[model samples]
Target chain A: MKNYFSSQFKLGILGGGQLGKMMLYDTRKYDIQTYVLDPSNEAPSKVACNHFTQGSLMDYETVLNFGRKVDVLTFEIESVNIDALETLEKEGIKVYPQPSVLRNIQDKGVQKDFYKKHNIPTASYEKYAFAKAVKESPQWLDNLPFIWKSCTGGYDGKGVSVVRTASDLDTLPEVPCIAEKMIPFKNELAVIVARNVSGEVKTYPVVEMEFHPEANQVEYVICPARIDETVAQKARDIAEKVSNAFGHVGLLAVEMFQTENDEILVNEVAPRPHNSGHYSIEGSFTNQFEQHLRAILDLPLGNTDSKVASVMVNLVGDEGYTGPVKYENIEHIMGMDGVTPHIYGKKETRPFRKMGHVTIVDHNIEKARTVAEKVKGSIKVIAQ
Target chain B: MKNYFSSQFKLGILGGGQLGKMMLYDTRKYDIQTYVLDPSNEAPSKVACNHFTQGSLMDYETVLNFGRKVDVLTFEIESVNIDALETLEKEGIKVYPQPSVLRNIQDKGVQKDFYKKHNIPTASYEKYAFAKAVKESPQWLDNLPFIWKSCTGGYDGKGVSVVRTASDLDTLPEVPCIAEKMIPFKNELAVIVARNVSGEVKTYPVVEMEFHPEANQVEYVICPARIDETVAQKARDIAEKVSNAFGHVGLLAVEMFQTENDEILVNEVAPRPHNSGHYSIEGSFTNQFEQHLRAILDLPLGNTDSKVASVMVNLVGDEGYTGPVKYENIEHIMGMDGVTPHIYGKKETRPFRKMGHVTIVDHNIEKARTVAEKVKGSIKVIAQ
Candidate 1:
């Protein structure tokens, strides 16, 4: 084994957002050398890494130059320059979760096809070169009420729309995309699996996703998704299969929908640690951040058992507020039992900007869910 | 209030070590920018901070030049340049715990006198300018069966001598020191107090320290020290007085000895986060690391309640091991319930060197203690 600690070895990371910031936590714990690159000067990861370089993550030259200085290259976001990673890989630098995995995930159209080829149970979908190409087909109206998602760069309800009618098509971008048949489901759920380079694997418990009634956004994430034992086992098995299929050497978060007919349909997959695993920080035997480190380093996988049932509530900037951010009534929420707030260090917050999150863990899942609701109602991320 | 987030505000840290690495956890959480100066290149805190400047923490010019770059300064170890901090104070840089407090606690003799001046209960002691000075004074031999501790820089049983006869004097350092009446104690205890600029305060529950008989070093730190209610309250009261007397901002850890007679005696104090509080990361409602951040940043103090009883077993290199370190049976310990290991990421293994720790938390303190003992017995930090 190489003695990398306090040595010349360096780990380079692309996309210095909250995920990268949290990942830096474990690197700090192991005293691993790390350098991060981000476009924003105030990136949350800027304060916690050995070095911070201000550059575009998608710029080929910038990423290529940064990757050359590091022993291993990894990323927090999928929208990075794969060409740069490929060049770095050719030059002998290791890229975890592999650039191939990122490539498969960057395009929803290709990701769905990869799932089909691997016999993974995913929602039925059709890929089109452009929205105009789909409109040109006379029988395209037959697939009405389907979900329309852009093949690339879709995040947090942006670059995605529901085509209820011809008029809805006017709102979507004229770019390559996917049209998927909407599956009616009783609940949304997720499972996060960690796999090391040596093939050791572990899967966290399934979590339930609760969405806002109007905004259609995830309101709270509840662990131990109130489901049958058989369903949970099935979800874990499927997630493990996905991890093995991709040969992923880090965290792979698999999101799914539990249909009314008692069938599980894969929604999508993230090659790195995902937002859904945030509850594990306070609830699990081993946190996702540390697990990522173990997986990337090919160390033995840790236990993923939950110590307590938990609920996670995202803290987004309140609509119509922007400037120096204030977490209104945060102390009141802290007064509630089992509430742990995580502020992401974003100084100026605009509407819908992700400022932080709060986790509520208790012996009883229902109690945790109730506390999560109160936390969501009491605390507001607003401009000062 | 100043918006330090993503702004020009800088926080300076002295003596970068494991404690500083843990404190950086919260500093990153709040996105507070920091600069750390340590003598060693392999300091654990070197990776997870905003700035790393290699320099002597006790050198006046080195410390002063580093202090000039930050808006506020603090430390992990007490053996820092107090005069430079005083100069920085005069020049308008805020130094937490105050240089006056460090001047008192950095030396065992002055620390004992401060306790006496404040009417705080501690072991009785007599100071001598040097070993020669003590030999010249025959009256000082009256307390022959005493513990002779060097006035400064005595850590982890080093620079400390248990004197039972005149022959012991030969092994003692020829420096100014103290001879204290050693109390036969049933257990060792500690309490961590956090105070802010506005005088807000909080104290963690007293924790019991278990020592290795042969090494005379602490092995396990058990939280919610299982002691009589009256004794616990007395310990807390003495700790509060010490914090008030010091007029310090940030964490003040007061180590104590509980005599068989149930009386409590102050041993020493660390003005920053201490090893005794490591269990807080997994057991407390508000961990000590975050509390340190809140105190120095002038934020409101958090609740100091324990979520569960926790026992932390220190992982040190086994005797006769020196080279690349490997944690043997680490996976076996990870399989146990409520066991979480924290590896410090120092790749080398020297005999008795702290490499990491394992924290076991449970509703039953006795059960957690049992698991911690098993963990200590099973894992071996050895040269690879």
Candidate 2:
């Protein structure tokens, strides 16, 4: 009962990226005042937020100063200075998805260790102090085809690689890292769990991430993951358990893999709105951004059911294009039924850059998938 | 072809009210830069747009200056300076729902005349230069009860009244006005027609406005009106005809009356997004705001079909409350399934002031309606 809607309540968001931009839409809907911090002056959220500060999110003083100005604080990205968040928390500023939870999740090594401590099912992994340790250990040759992930600073497709050969270990960065046994998976699935300060919790329907046949990238995110009901239910249960373990407020998107034998193993989790839930903007009764707001505000959460099945395709910069962004054939995709493209307002696009996303929705999941394919094939993010 | 997305192209909007605020959401989604001008610095759209100017929308110089700064110009409210818009259009600034179309719809007398000229079905009405003309003519007494509407500068139930008694005529404002024969109607319906600059047109499903039995005010707006399919089709056809008659580029929300004989009579039309279509945000495949952007930009029009049944209840300020606004029991409504409230960000409350709106969407129309009633009965927009 803080009168958060259309009142003087200030919500400060760290890292004004695409996620923060989308979150601003909901804040605007509720007429809540918002301030955003990002290093770039042209951050996607700069225009939408009530105030925009250009500063490094990783700078302790910058983060602390921004946190002090708001009634409640949250972050769209995990790379923010956690020590500042702890200081703000000590001063009674409400920081959702608490700093402790972020501290645990910010490093892959700590996150994996937390999962093991909580008895959460995950791919077996070994934490290494540095990539040199794995290179020097001849015994590591036994676990040849493992996944090498930089313990910190890994994002998108960066800082992660598959070590199938001895030379692959040489290519690893000199940072704290983890090598996990690669579990063959049938499908990559995800569940977005929302938990409020009052302990109210809900999970969105399991979504399946369909990978490109040859590109080895996520091609489509289909809601209600064309999987067995039992598997989907198990995913939701596990996601809720993860939420409880973190005691985190706001949204937690838990990514997992469905093993060939049908075992569900957690891949990782983002304690904020994930790209996988971008489809919810048009697909769910309550979009993930709005749900995150509800969770952080401790208001009653909206229904998580989808009005129609949805499929989302990320619009990345086309290869060999690296200048002012141009969305080619965008109008062609716009003509397709139930297609909505969300441009992230990034003026420039480089190869594989996360430029935007398009969502296709229909009553029939198959029809939605078909239209999503057309949308994916037609629209290309290129240089002007 | 203009590369509006994340480009140099700018969209200018007059009257930064709730409609403009909602439209801003779509503009943000598309990363389309926008400039907004409103008389009040606290306009809901001020924070969201790329640039905001506090200036009178009806002032010729103010509107012209703002319009000159952008490639295209539009308005959320109809009372903007049309002469300025005409000048901008002549200067090659695309003004959507065209300045000419807005000119016709801006005045009640001219709008009614255009309907007659275009052979559109509408209520029989007589235009008078002044209220004194109707008062001095005793023969008007024979007409008895009728609807009195001011020819210009009327909005949100203001400047419109039911003239049933002699004193009611005295209460009328001394201005250009219209007297329409009251036609007993079964339901007041609306159809939102979207027409792009290229002349591509589409219509949303008819929505029925259910009024409060005693208050005689619209209480709920239900989509896919619970009427015969033939009647609904007629309403849509008439709306399209109205859109075609104006050759309007953008959204024209045609409000109609489904008469006792199932005839559809055009009551009026809004050349921009209207309150009746607010439910589309949660119900339709593409909401009206996004559709308006597509039409104005001349991009392909989106699907207008509803994904689920929806009922919208306007959250007007409670009687006898006129200070800082507080939404009582809003949390109760938020707890309801499929309920989403959109606060307009107006800080003050006056009797019957439109503070916000709540939309309830469900797979079943009846269930949505039931939830809408619960939402209406629970939330009260009042002063703290």
Candidate 1 per-residue lDDT, tens place, B1-384, comes to: 544544567988897778888888877766678899999998877777878999999899999999999989999888899999999999999999899999999899999999999999898888988765666656557767778888998887777777888778877889889888888999899999999888988899999999877566779999999999999999998899999999999999999999999999999999998889999988886789888877887876776888678999988889999998787887677657678777786778898888888889887899999999899989898887
Please provide, for model 2 over A1-384, each residue's C-alpha lDDT reduced to its tens digit, 9 standing for 90 to 100.
668887889999998999999999899888899999999999999999999999999999999999999999999999999999999999999999899999889999999999999999999888899876887766566878878999999888678888998787777788999988899999999999999989999999999998655345677999989999999999999999988999999999999999999999999999999999999999999999999999999999888989899999999888899999999999999999999999999999998889999999999999999998888878889999
B270-377 per-residue lDDT for model 2 (tens digits): 999999999999999889999999999999999999999999999888889999999988888889999999999889999888888999999999999998889888
Q: What TM-score would every model get versus the actual structure? A: 0.88, 0.98
lDDT, candidate 2, at B215 = 44
* DockQ score of the complex predicted as candidate 1: 0.33
Model 2 earns a TM-score of 0.98
Q: How accurate locally is residue A222 in candidate 1, as Cα lDDT from 0 to 100?
A: 91
lDDT of model 2 at position B359:
92
Which ranges of candidate 2 are over 4 A from the true structure? A135-139, A212-217, B135-140, B212-217
